[model samples]
Target chain A: EAEVAQSPRYKITEKSQAVAFWCDPISGHATLYWYRQILGQGPELLVQFQDESVVDDSQLPKDRFSAERLKGVDSTLKIQPAELGDSAMYLCASSSRGTGYGEQFFGPGTRLTVL
Target chain B: AQSVAQPEDQVNVAEGNPLTVKCTYSVSGNPYLFWYVQYPNRGLQFLLKYITGDNLVKGSYGFEAEFNKSQTSFHLKKPSALVSDSALYFCAVRDKGGAGGGNKLTFGTGTQLKVEL
Candidate 1:
């Protein structure tokens, strides 16, 4: 089965350090998403991309977080000067279509820990 | 904004017994509901979704969900449970209105299901 790919399954860094995660969506998928999952809470959307353009990033913390999908196939999320509260599981998901009705497929995710 | 709720924090069921996980949603217009499962240290996996047709929707791994419009609920159920079925389940919702031309999903806190031997 075709699946979304994520790199750096686990990451540990001190607070104030910079970290980045990468994701490659399933082939032909046009919509990609970045989400953060706390220990006991469901995932929350950080950003959404349609093709090479950003569709929504209302919930993303602009001051410290940034995400990009230059070619629309692969994406990267970065957090500079990471904070302890930023520790969580970062998930990447993709859907075949950009419509709200399509079901999304997820990647294994990258676990981030800030000391 | 669309939102989802998982009333129960945890549910325990014995193996071979039927199991259910409750979910409710709120949306301005119609809703697109989805159920997802997550194992330890993993990402969310899509289980099923309810769009517009039938009230009962069957999904992967012998799981199913019923959409009740009046009650605004979409609960996940399985006829029989297995030890491997123990995991964290989440319910998510998206408004059909397409407010920002984005397919944003709002997820519930999540429910932990334990299928004991």
Candidate 2:
């Protein structure tokens, strides 16, 4: 089974530093999502991309966070001046189009910690 | 707004015992419900989902869920539990009538399931 790929399984950064995470969705998947999971809470959507265009980013903190899927196959999420509260698991998921309400396949997330 | 609720913070079940992880949801229109499991230091894994037909939906790892529209709940269950089954479970929901073919999922605070040997 093809799986979404993520890099930097763990990251530690000082507050005010910049950090970035990468994700490569399963081949042929058109929809990609980025989520943040707090210690005791379920994941929350940060951004969604359809092909190379952003579909939704209502919950993303645009002031500090930015995400891009330039070629529509791989994506990168970057945070400038990371904060302590930004520490969490950053997850990436993907699903193919044409599948009505397709179930998303998730990648092993990148754990970010800000000190 | 779409939302999900996981009532229990934790559930304990012995190995070989039937286990259940409860979930309830609220949505504006019809709901697309899903169940996911997470192990330590990993991402959420899809378990199953309820779209339209059949109230009962079976998923990976011999797990199943029943969608009760009247109750607005989709609970995950397994006939027998194993020690490896212990993990965090989450329930999520998306409104079927949401705009732009909404794929946004509102997830509930996860429930910790501990299946001891």
Q: Pick the candidate with the highest DockQ.
A: 1
Docking class of 2: medium
Q: Note the residue pairs that clash in candidate 2.
A: none
Deviating ranges (above 4 Å) for candidate 2 = B97-100
- Return the lDDT, model 1, position A12: 98
Residue pairs whose backbone atoms clash in candidate 1: none
Where is the poorest 10-residue window by lDDT in model 2 chain A? A95-104
Question: What's the true lDDT of residue B1 in model 2?
Answer: 72
Deviation (Å) of B47 in candidate 2: 0.8
- Per-residue lDDT of A1-115 in model 1, one digit per residue for the tens? 9999999999999999999999999999999999999999999889988998988888899999999999989999999989999999999999987445858899999999999
